[model samples]
Target chain A: MTKTRRPNRAEVEPIRVATVMDVPGVIALDEEVTGLLKPAYWRDMFERYGARPGGSRVFLVAESDGRIDGFIIGEVRAWEFGSSPSGWVFAVQVRSRLRVQGLGSRLFEAVCESFRAAGVDRIRTMVAPDNTEIHSFFRSQGMMAGPFIELEMRLD
Target chain B: MRLQKATEIALYAVLELAIDPERQLTAVEIAERYGISTHHLAKVLRDLGRGGLVDSVRGVGGGYRFAGDAKRLTLMDVISLFEDVSADTDELPPQEAGQEIARGLRFVLTELDTQSVATLRSITISTMLKLIVRRPWATIALEPRRPTVRRGR
Candidate 1:
């Protein structure tokens, strides 16, 4: 008889990747994902872009406890990378139950590194003008958050 | 809406993977955890895999694993990794409602890329959580909308 041991929380580190197939997990991240839009849309993006090569897109995921906890979603456009193209982040989301952990940052770094490997030199993310959640992050990183806001209200 | 949907899924998937560092999750497992359709979840997972965010294992004891360390990762990088799924604003099939919303949300993605990695570095998972953990009924000051009673899961 032998005992099988599971890795302790400290010993188990978050896995980052260039891509993974965990739609349900990402879809469940938060309102940012589950409540933000529909599932069909995600399917469309993957079919169109993920299957294409040399387009400068990378999709990263973070997994813990055999579950998808958080993610950062974005892409690369040659025009943004340099004079040619670069990667940019579109959406960043994490599970509400898994907040206060370093999941978002992990996803963020994984995306940037993927771009670097592909020779992409730039990246970006659009944010709510008043989203102070990550305002200091952009300021500190020296990345410019274009002055803009999404004029939106729930269509009653 | 497609753009928003794309990222929303990407973020959640990454979070799922991050929290369960030691476990290897199947698309089905991830989907089940979220209570979404496994078929839909598989599509997103495949897209992420293609974008280089994840690698698929082909065996009884195999499943998806992170290609790198999560903390050193950045949202920009993850987006780029998953960019293929949400890459072009010009290529999506025409939908009036979707187009209208996408035209507006495009700014959000663009801002995401332009912002520096260091910008995200100073920020922590804690802060991101705080920002997004909105309780409009509890903390919102604007004319509050009628609250919907949601039963606990």
Candidate 2:
């Protein structure tokens, strides 16, 4: 009997900067996780972050067999609350069944590398109090409570 | 972890005054509305006063008014005054199942505690007031009105 070995993640999956053609795959992966179809939001994000001229904004994706298994988006923002310039990651998603294999972490690191290249010293992201999964992921990545406090008010 | 009664009362009193900074609410009025003890509420109010979170008004229509900045003062600021929000997992003893299980449980508990403290620190008094107003059943309005329970002084 002949044994067939499965390919390792690094060999099968490659992390790279997202292109315009990767938008649909990114949208599908996000929809699978959130259970909401938001093609327009993903396209808009691609235009604003992925297609921007400057390298300050980053949009990275992890691909396996030509499928986007994960994605992360972040940008450099400064002086919002008297703080210095820092990288702010606003979105990240990995396919549910394919999680726990470090794909999300790889995408996260790729974005961090982009931020580091952009001359930022710190990184920040906001997570809902109830989202323990994402919170745990960021915590594992050495993120903790930041100085800024988020407040909101309703107009209606 | 459950908040102490004093912490709950302090939150109510602070929110009452913070929602309308110009409005003043006596400890008795706040206690009556919440159906809690006036004496206990008075003590809590005194602590809040000492913390510089509220000011005691004198003369007619005198009561307690919020003194702290609503935008900057977070719920954790008020909660820390009455409760110990720190995660003390190190105090846990080893379980019969062994140190491994105990350590695992401690880690989970510590994570929960950290997240709770983070959530409290993120929400400001102003944000809480907005959330309250947005509730569908919160038709009672922001104005302080006399509750149905009438307690004699």
Candidate 3:
């Protein structure tokens, strides 16, 4: 019987801070997943999170074989609605075909390390109810319900 | 997450009508497509008509047409008409045993309810339509398929 060798994850895909050159890859990956092209939105995100020098905001991407497979964006928010400073992950995405291969988990851990370095003890994020994939991923990472409620009303 | 039969039917009817705002479909046609009861769908459609979400036509070949703005109409709006989406807490008479576990469970359930409501509120009919179109099977399921006729050998 022949045995298949398992590839080293770190050697196969490396997670690193995103640069200006990586903005296009991030945008393309996002569009591939969401089917929407919002170059301006992504450019603005890169400008605020990647280009800026603040350690509070972090934008990281996973690269494999010179292709961007995933990206995560988060920042440390303080005293928003009377809560203590915490890391808020606004967006995270991995290529659909490459999901469940631990890329998302690795990206999540990389961002969490950045958050810890920024001196935040807790992390927060909002996921849609129908987005079970993300919910399960967060749950696997030991995230549970937090002491907060989101309320909204429509205005014409 | 549970919805009343009326609410579910209303959602199907509304989405069907909204698929093409110009296309009018009778309650019977909508019910038939979904394999649901026409009588029940009629009641739901009547309520939707009162809600100003649909227009009922009176004469030959006339039916209900979507009147509400698909971009503005949300699943929560339609659901609120037939049922309350709020999470209601069960009052357990003061008991020492399992109190902590009960409190924790309640908190989790409340959080889930909050997330559900927010998700429903954020998703509009237009968004739902886009999602439906994006699904690989949706196109095949939604489009009318022509019947194949077998030729004599």
Candidate 4:
């Protein structure tokens, strides 16, 4: 009789380009993390990142057991806030139970690879100052403070 | 029902077409009017096209126009075109409810999901337009919210 070794969680899921099929899984993960159902927002994101014909955008998902457990979305833009061209990561979500298993890092690196291929040297993302977990994650990814600052006003 | 940003954009794009069924509005013009990303709006327009809610043309001066009967289109229809409207509760893992209160909270969440879908299905696009004139922001279309000309400094 032949015996096969069971794969670990990190080895179980393979990271791949996200498709329309992954949208529901992505939404479910986001809702579990953020407590909001933003399906419309995700649909728009999927179209821009998942369906784009060429460079400048990337959407990646880590799938296992026919379900998405982690995903990242990013795009390249120039001259925003008077800054030069850079890659901006708009969203990242990993299934809660699967954190620290290197799945999220793999997704991040996949998007970063796409950004680098698009000719952008810098990658940026906005995270609330108090979000220590995200801050630490970005820090681990070698992200630092950038030149631009976000400014907003309330008319009400 | 809380709408996704994409759904809201879809509604606006459809509304623009509804207000002028003959004019084929380019995604760029619509995005410019709202100060949103043209790239994103373009994708939304493409989805609307695929959903059979709008038709598109190619080459110079090409754009999109409403393809379906406006009065018959509901907000649910537009939203469903972009997203899966079902709650998809089966996707959620079974939660460990050790206490009665925890189970009650879970029930409330499920009820909220049901109510959200029900409300979205009830409102039609035409009925949503009727709500515009009643809102404070509606003054921009109904009347000149600002003076026609600024007074001499």
Candidate 5:
């Protein structure tokens, strides 16, 4: 006799975008995998980018067991954050234990699909030189490393 | 949905208090700071006092004290205080019976009534204040920078 397990229906629901309800849960998930950028900063980001016109900035959160396990925040900006030709992967992170099982890919593909629907033609992200693991993650997704490097300075 | 004029004014005024936070400033000063008017500023302050955001003192050396902190103050929280959400619901004009437009309108109005204030407050006083100091995008607006005043000999 041969038997196969049916795939979970809940997994077919697609990655869900962040609602006002998921802010704290998603923030906690982010803290587990990356340096904390402060709750206020995150609140500002989701509010501005999520509610932006044209549905350009999409924030998706993955949940399991009634808790956020990961999130992806991406924006469709033309030249800059809003300028037109591209969408930038502003941030995406998954819980440490859930890393290898496709949650990040689901979140990434969900964001890319949303941006493609928004008419965004290209995707970009600024990755640090030292983060070899994350660099490999992007490469595995068939993303090419461009020649341009991001540089910034704050004048006070 | 647009923020009620009073709510916008109060945000700017209270943020000014957060910046200064020493003593109360006059109605005219607050208005001028935001490029609003004294009459309008006073109206906003009265609303703030009603909402318990700022306390008023009478006479010389009396102005306004921030009854709250910037971190604790969400822009949404402040705007909601001045806005009458229930009263706004009362103002919906009844329309034709066939379409049920009122139901849809009520839904949108309710959403805006809740969402707009919370969104605005999400952008805190600190970011707005920083924008004032570093107006990098001022050039982007398509307005004439200098108006010519003809010199008469």
Candidate 6:
């Protein structure tokens, strides 16, 4: 008699470029990280940015045993705040159980490589100002605040 | 500030479902645990379902399940399902000398409400559940109440 054991989390598959097929799983993961379920937004992003490769956008996912455990989405933006183009990460999240294993850093670095390939020297991302965890993570990644500041008004 | 009966019920329902995410329990089961009416609980459950916090299944072995990851759900999200915290300037009376004190009172109340909502939003459902199960006496024991001495008159 023999017993089979599941592989350890560290031994799982490495990160790879995401595909159109990974959209559903990616959306599910996003909703898990962010409580809002915006299927239309995810679907549109897949169709417009992630369906094919070699665009200004970069979508990467970490898969293990054919399941996506983490994902990141980034793109190049220009002249938004009267500055040159730079890589802007829109979202990045890892499964709660699989966090702190460098999955987020791996995804971030992969996106940075893509941005480098696209001729951008700097990468940027927006996090809720009070989110100290994300702030520290970004700082650990060598990301610092740029010249711009976010301003908003609650219209309700 | 008192939470409405519906809001209180919704909070318990979410807590019960979050306690065991893998286990799907019906409204009746949750209401029984809390000693509340199942009829009213069903209505609250429907509101939760509509709020995208829980999903329902019909027929045999049917029940409501936590829709998303419980850790992602903040206490604010669950409370919003049963309470309308939407800001409305209409609540303020006409701006006049007679209502000056009333307006100032409303401003203070609104500020308190905003601050409390921010606090609730920062606390996730998972954090609340963990606190609920922790030994309450541990903190009390560490910080024993200081005995007050009466001065001789």
State the lDDT of candidate 3 residue by residue for A2-49, as single tens digits.
Answer: 998887554358999999888889989999999999999999999999
Which residue ranges in model 5 land beyond 4 Å of their true spot?
A: A3-14, A35-37, A52-54, A80-84, A147-156, B1-153
- What is the alpha-carbon lDDT for the whole of candidate 1? 0.58
Scored against the native two-chain complex, candidate 2 gets a DockQ of 0.04
The native-contact fraction of candidate 5 is 0.00
Q: Estimate, for each residue in B1-153, the C-alpha lDDT of model 2 and write its tens digit.
A: 789999999999999899889999888889899999999999999999999999999888999999998866878899999988877755555365577877888887887897787667766776677667666245435635544657879
TM-score of 2: 0.50
- Candidate 3 ranges beyond 4 A from true positions: A1-4, A8-11, B1-153
Which residue runs does candidate 4 get wrong by more than 4 Å?
A1-7, A80-82, B1-153
When 1 and 2 are scored with lDDT, the better candidate is 2
lDDT (tens digit, per residue) of candidate 4 on B1-153: 567788879988988887767789899899988888888888899899999888998889989988876545666789888777665455334565555676666666876675456545544555455555445345436853443556886
The lDDT for every candidate, in the order shown, is 0.58, 0.82, 0.84, 0.76, 0.69, 0.77
Off-target runs (Cα >4 Å) in candidate 1 are A1-13, A17-21, A30-37, A49-55, A80-84, A134-142, A145-156, B1-153
Docking class of 2: incorrect
* Model 3 interface root-mean-square deviation: 10.6
**Per-prediction interface RMSD in Å:** 9.4, 11.4, 10.6, 19.6, 16.4, 8.7
Best by lDDT: 3
Tens-place lDDT per residue, model 4, A85-130, is 8888988888878875667778888888888899987799987644
Candidate 1 vs candidate 6: the TM-score winner is: 6
* Pairs with backbone N, CA or C atoms under 3 Å apart (clashes), candidate 2: none
Q: Is the docking of candidate 3 incorrect, acceptable, medium or high quality?
A: incorrect
Per-residue lDDT of A1-156 in model 1, one digit per residue for the tens?
A: 899997543234475542437665665554454577556766665555454534566665567766766656567765521245667777666665554454555566677787888787667666554464555444323344432333556988
| lDDT, model 5, position B89 | 57
Task: Give TM per candidate.
Answer: 0.40, 0.50, 0.50, 0.46, 0.44, 0.48
Residue A156 lDDT in model 5? 81
